[model samples]
Target chain A: MPDSFDNVSVSTKANVYFDGKVVSHSLILADGRKKSLGVIFPGEYHFGTADPEVMEITAGACEVVIDGTTETRAVAAGSSFTVAANSGFTIRVTDSPCEYICSFGTP
Target chain B: MPDSFDNVSVSTKANVYFDGKVVSHSLILADGRKKSLGVIFPGEYHFGTADPEVMEITAGACEVVIDGTTETRAVAAGSSFTVAANSGFTIRVTDSPCEYICSFGTP
Candidate 1:
């Protein structure tokens, strides 16, 4: 995975959820693709998606179950999972915060 | 303050402090100036700096006291505080999460 993105636009404010249990910074790539870098504290979280999304684990680990799926898979750093458009997933972090980059509009 | 920054480089990994009580995403401007966008949860935190920094509160509020100082000031959203190079500051968030943009090496 790329360490950083160059020539992008970034928002200063954060997108806080679950009372700051989950926090992320929004950014736009030079090609206009939207992405968010986020941290999920030790807890379970369910997120719905509008566009087709890809969640890439950057640090730590997480167990995820895609909506309508029964199997929960453990995703480690440098791994990723995908969800269909208009779908959702449930993610759980055990002891440490799980960090990820969520890319929206992935095909 | 500016809502967002363009033509920048952003890293995906986060900087977690105080056991995730504070989280930030590092970035660099087009001119190679370093900056970070961060979220501070409801707690007190002390941070030392290697370079002069300007903390711009983008959302929520905080009380801050620079290192070696005795005065604590209430800084609301859209306001800022400066910390000198080789110095530090103490920040406290009472009820809600505080969001900030820290610009490093400021003059």
Candidate 2:
């Protein structure tokens, strides 16, 4: 099958965070849906979301500690996890850089 | 220092090519510029551009034969090359997957 969202346009600015350990490109679609495609270098980070998000691991693996959870979950490439709107999560990249696509949805 | 264009927004749509060997996310910045962040698997491919493009190798390496040259040049991670508008080029990825950001410019 073809890749997802192959028909949309992209912006020129990049969304960078955590002292450049996390870098992403922001996207605005024709229908107004927003998303970010980025790569995270090996590190630990905590993030909060305003909208519900579907975080897909496009490449590499990482461990996540989502809200209400004390244990960490292993997330590998080709796998995905969702976070509720207004909630938060912690991600730890143990090895290689992790590539991801964060798709935002209505809360 | 910091990564380039690290504050722009991206589109929700993805730009897939060569039957998934090349996959990218499109971005449309607030300033109206366009770019695509994607990865290219190990393979040879031919491409043509409608606008001048700066192909930056963010991770990994690849070889490129731009319009005027028949000799392929090595492009490792942290390096880049340029192609003029309406021109075409051929790229060969001899080893690992090549991660790139193709930035478009005025003709």
Candidate 3:
């Protein structure tokens, strides 16, 4: 399973498989046309603080708390959604880390 | 950071962030039209055992050992390639776990 990529330097990223824990990482968002995205399972947050348009493709069912309001959204597998930039949200997993993919536009 | 998805049951998957270590997971391949894929960083393998046509999008440049032969291919960021099924390969990381995405078609 040891595979390495060339040219593109490996960056430091963290995935904390736990509840009530916060983890943060710095990402250089892609250009509007380039997709800069990654996956986050249940019990994790994928935050892109510098970009204005952030999108998440929910890979499982989960609850999202956006800007102080909590709502239950059933993000079907393979579906995608957008979260406005600077909109800090908390996602509490009802199952586990819900599998989801997210992308952000570079400044 | 905890979020859960509906309908889609959370499945058990293993990811070993190491070199020369082998990890395996069972996946239900999607239909040809439905894109079933996920990301794997450097020093890891994403193997789709059942399907005949498996595709991988290299998120970073890496070397891939197909079947029993070894070759170094620079898979530029955002480029995609297909691995014919049953063509088992071992990828040795020269950088780290190369970032890549892979999908498989259902039988």
Candidate 4:
């Protein structure tokens, strides 16, 4: 059996990475402005729930705020969070850059 | 205000394209085989609902099979379909290659 999925094609895709306090390869809009970029903070902060769910992952160690609640979750490399569609939250990173994949559906 | 959203990052992403009857830049698994590959037929086929939703799009003009029901929907380039999480079904493309994005979460 094939190891990966086949019979699919994607066009115009990009990769991005984030370093604590810095963002790179962020998605740009028609006006050439960064769109839906992720930020890595030195520590976790309070992020209230909002529309367009927010997904977060900690490349290093960090904490997260979900739906007005606070939790100290141990986020490791490659770990991912699927923020409910149209949900709100906040995240704080410690020790290293909080890396993750933030994508949007076709508008 | 920025035209697009901001404060997000993505690492290691890819795009694929379809040309009515061929698949390219498909996602590979550890086994080096095509897993869950999409096929483009001359016309639309029936696809039942299954786990791990399947997303489909039409690069050219075609039809689709959703949740065991056959529906002739107009699919255009750049349009995308988000198959419900863990759904199963079949799709038959007509006139052109039925293009779409098939991505899997980290295992």
TM-score of each: 0.98, 0.55, 0.39, 0.32
DockQ head-to-head 2 vs 4, winner = 2
Chain B, candidate 4: TM-score: 0.46
- Find the 10 residues in a row with the least total lDDT in model 3 chain B: B1-10
* Model 4 stretches astray by more than 4 angstroms: A1-25, A28-39, A47-51, A54-58, A105-107, B1-107
Which digits, one per residue and each the tens of the lDDT, describe model 3 over residues B1-107? 11211121112222323321322222231221222323344453544345554444433455555665557555555555556667665554445334333445532
Query: What is the fnat value (0 to 1) for candidate 2?
Result: 0.06
Candidate 3 chain A worst ten-residue window by lDDT: A1-10
* Chain B only, TM-score of each candidate: 0.97, 0.89, 0.49, 0.46
Interface RMSD over true interface Cα atoms for each candidate: 0.7, 8.5, 15.8, 15.4
lDDT pick, better of 2 and 3: 2
Clashing pairs in 1: none
Over the stretch B17-39, how does candidate 1's per-residue lDDT look in tens digits? Answer: 99999999999998889999999
- Candidate 4 RMSD to the real structure: 17.5
Model 1: per-residue lDDT, tens digit, A11-99? Answer: 98899998778999999998999999999999998999999999999999999999999999999999999999999999999978999
> How many residue pairs clash in each candidate at the backbone level?
0, 21, 26, 50
Query: Which stretch of 10 consecutive residues in model 4 chain A shows the poorest summed lDDT?
Result: A1-10
Best model per lDDT? 1
Candidate 2, residues A1-107: lDDT per residue as tens digits?
A: 11345434454434557745676666555677776777777889999988999898887899999988898899998888899999999999978678788889962
lDDT of model 3 at position A69: 59
lDDT of each: 0.93, 0.74, 0.39, 0.40
- TM-score of chain B taken alone, candidate 2: 0.89
